[model samples]
Target: MKRRPRRSVPALLTALVLLAGCVLVTVVTVQLILGERPWISYDAVAATLHDLHWTDLLPAVAGGVLALLGLVLLLAAVLPGAATVLPLDGLFDSGAARGGYRSTLRAAAAGVDGVSAARVKLRTRRVKVRVETSRTQPDGLTDAVRAAVTDRLDRIGPATRPAVAVRVRAPRRTS
Candidate 1:
C-alpha cells in the first residue's frame, strides 16, 4: 500500500522547541534592554541558574537529563529522516510499488521443511521470522528458515540489507 511518511512530526516538534527558545531569548533581551519585570522574573531564574551546585544531586541529574534530551533533539533535527516504506522495483511504473516484505518473508519461512506456519516482522534493518511446527526433528529448521529468508531478501534487494533471525517454536501435539 502507498502511504505518505510522517517525517514532519519530528520536524514539527523541533520547530516548536526552536520557537519556544526564540520566545525566551526575545523576552530575556527585552528584559535586559527595557528593565521590565515580566511573566517570569529573570532575576530569580538567573539566581537559580547561577546557584546550581554539583553537590545538589537532584538538580544536577535533572540538568544532565535535560541536556541529553536537547542533544537528542539536535541530532534528530540534523539527521535525515528515516524511510518509512521500502521501495521495490516497479513493474508498470517507476517508484509505484513499496513493500515491507512481511508476507514475502513469512511465505519464504513457511516454505521450509517442518515449518507449518510462520510469522515475519520486517523492519528497515532487521527481519525476524518465527516458525511453528509439529514435526519432532527441528534440528536444522532454524538454519533452513534463515537461509530461505536471506535468499528472498537478496532477491527483493532493499536499499539496506537487513539481518535475518529465525526462531523455531516447540512442536505441537499431534493429537
Candidate 2:
C-alpha cells in the first residue's frame, strides 16, 4: 500500500548537533572534575588525580552513562517513530528460521527508501529493527521501516506479523 508522507525532519541535524554538544560539555565537565581540574582554562591546573582513584573513575563512568543517556534521549526525541527499543533476545530467540527471517527483514529494510542502514534483531518474541535513514523524521522513517519490514516478513510466508518494531536513525555519514 502506498503511504502518505508526513512532516520531515529538516532540523534534525541541528538538534542532534546540539545534543552532541551538550553531551560533550557534560562529559568534559564531569571528567575534568574527576581529574581534579574542573575549570576550563588555558593553563593546566595542578591535577593530582593520582589520588582520585576509584572516586575519580566515578565521573568517568557517570560521564559514559550520561553520554549514553544523552544519545539515547536525542535518538528518541529526534527519531521516535523510526526506532523501537526492544530486548536483544526478542526476535531470534526462538530458533534459526526466526533468526534468518529477521535477517531477511533487515536486508529488506536496508533496501527501502530513505534507509541508509538496517539492523534486524530478535529478542524473545519481539522483532526489533533499527533503520538508519537519510530522512530524519521518526514518523516518516518509522512508517517506511514498518511497511518494508511487514512486506518482507509477509513475503517470507504465511506466518504472524512478527512484532515489527521500528527505529529511524539519521545516517552516521551525516553526523
Model 2 gets an lDDT of 0.63
Point out where model 1 deviates above 4 Å: 1-9, 18-39, 46-63, 77-99, 111-117, 121-128, 139-165, 172-175
TM-score, cand. 2 vs. native: 0.39
In candidate 2, which residue ranges exceed 4 Å CA deviation?
1-99, 136-139, 158-160, 171-175
Per-candidate TM-scores read 0.50, 0.39
Worst 10-residue stretch by lDDT in candidate 2? 82-91
- Give the alpha-carbon lDDT of every model: 0.76, 0.63
Candidate 2 residue-wise lDDT, 93-170, digit = tens: 322344455678888888887778889886545679988766645457688778887887666542234578887777
Q: What tens-digit string does per-residue lDDT give for candidate 1 at 1-175? A: 2344655766788789899999988987887789776667778989987888778887878989989988887776676554555655535322222344677778889999788899987655788888998877688889989999999977877655789988899665566
Residue pairs with colliding backbones in model 1 are none
Among these predicted structures, which one has the highest lDDT?
1
